[model samples]
Target: MVLISLVTGASSGLGRVLAELLCEKGHRVYVIARRKNLLEELKKQCKNLEGEVIIIPGDLSDGNFRKKLISQILKKEKKIDYLFNNAGFGRAILFEKQNKKEIENMFKVNVIAYEHLAALVLSSMKKSNNGRIINIGSVVAFTPLPYFTAYNSTKSAVYGFNRSLIYELKGLKVTSTVVLPARMKTGFAEKAYDCYKEKGRNMCIEKFNKIAESPYVVAKNIIKNMNKGKEIITPTLRAKMWYSTRYFGFVVDFVMKYILGPKERKHLEQAVLKEDYKNS
Candidate 1:
């Protein structure tokens, strides 16, 4: 049976790699992104894929578009077999420096859109009696770092959602899998750095540059584990190691603060002082 899968943010980065891989595996893929031209290019690149590719050009942040996309999918397919909630971006700036509009946009795509889409698809999934949801999160969800405060929080919300969904869908053929991946060479960081550079922030780490895996490698592991009934997939050895850090609890926090504290403290202190002056 050819499975039907919906992949968001499929025009680039990890989502693009995952969508292409799904096509090659003979799964009918519905890909959504803001870039129509890139989606067209992906279609051409996947010409030899055994399954059909359907491209939808829209923004996940838009409620109307989300409804229309879900409606179109249900109208055409009996049920969506897989839903990959992979549309999200990173903000690399101090928390006080982060834009309110951008923060709302992140939550709209990362949390609200993900949850809404899952609800929309759940009815059909329950009817069909089988489905899988793979939400692409990050290791930062567990190991929070400075500069990515909002991004990390959003992913942590996803982590919590994925965990609770496992119980909610119990006894059904449906399952939820959350993927927490370490740094990967998918240009996600480069985009994040675009924000970092503008703020004159130093968010770079040599370790991430040295050990980051490729998106294809990360996607392959996620699909393989999701197939094997794994509810939480952590791609790459480093990601698994980072996940293990949760066991150490505050030790992880201490280490993060040690690494990031010096550079970020002054900015946070200044912000606090400014707020205090306004109240006075």
Candidate 2:
């Protein structure tokens, strides 16, 4: 069966890689992002794939843009088999240090937009009777990070949303899978470090360098699990272990206080100071 898949944040990172893999597997893939040039580049590179590829460049955070995108997709394909809500952005700053605009942007992109897009595509998915909704969550959602308060919170919301939505659609053909990934060696960490540097603060870039995994690897794992119809997929072994350990109340509390707490506090202080400098 030829499945029609829609992937948001397909300009780069795991979304782009997943789009390519799905295309190679003979699934019609639609790539959406705000970067037109990058989307075109992806289309060009994916020409060798067996399936069809369509590019729609727009900000998912904009409700009008999402509505337009859905309309366009319906006009072309008439239905969607999969919806991948993968677009997200984050800043490594304390919650108090984050401005109202930044907080709103995070909520808009990570929570509201994803919900709206899923709703928009859900009817068609239900009609297809074998639909999948893959939401890209993070390990931070299970274990909150100090400096990444808003990002972690948003991901937690995604996780909760996926859980509830899956229950609500229990009798339906639609399946919602939430993927929790660890720190990926994508533009995400680099951009956060760059923002810190731009504010004249020296962030511990080496920490990210040590633990971050490749985007391609993460993307591959996500696709592998999605094919198996997993309800919650943790891409890396480390992520799986961490989340598993976190489920134990005493172990999680101990680790949070002794292992991750100090480093997180230090990083958050630096990040908050840097953000303050930028605002000044």
Report the number of the highest-lDDT candidate.
1
Q: Rate residue 81 of model 1 by lDDT.
A: 92
For TM-score, the strongest prediction is: 2
lDDT of 1 by residue, 50-158 (tens): 8778999999999999999998999988789999999998866667667799999999999999999999999999988888989998888888867688999999999
Pairs that collide, model 1: none
User: Where is model 2 more than 4 Å wrong at Cα?
Assistant: 194-203, 268-280
Per-residue lDDT of model 2, residues 97-132, tens digit only: 677898898899999988999999888878777688
TM-score for candidate 1, please give it. 0.88
Count backbone overlaps in model 1: 0
Q: What is the C-alpha RMSD of each candidate to the true structure, in Å?
A: 4.2, 3.1
Per-prediction TM-score to the true structure, in the order listed: 0.88, 0.89
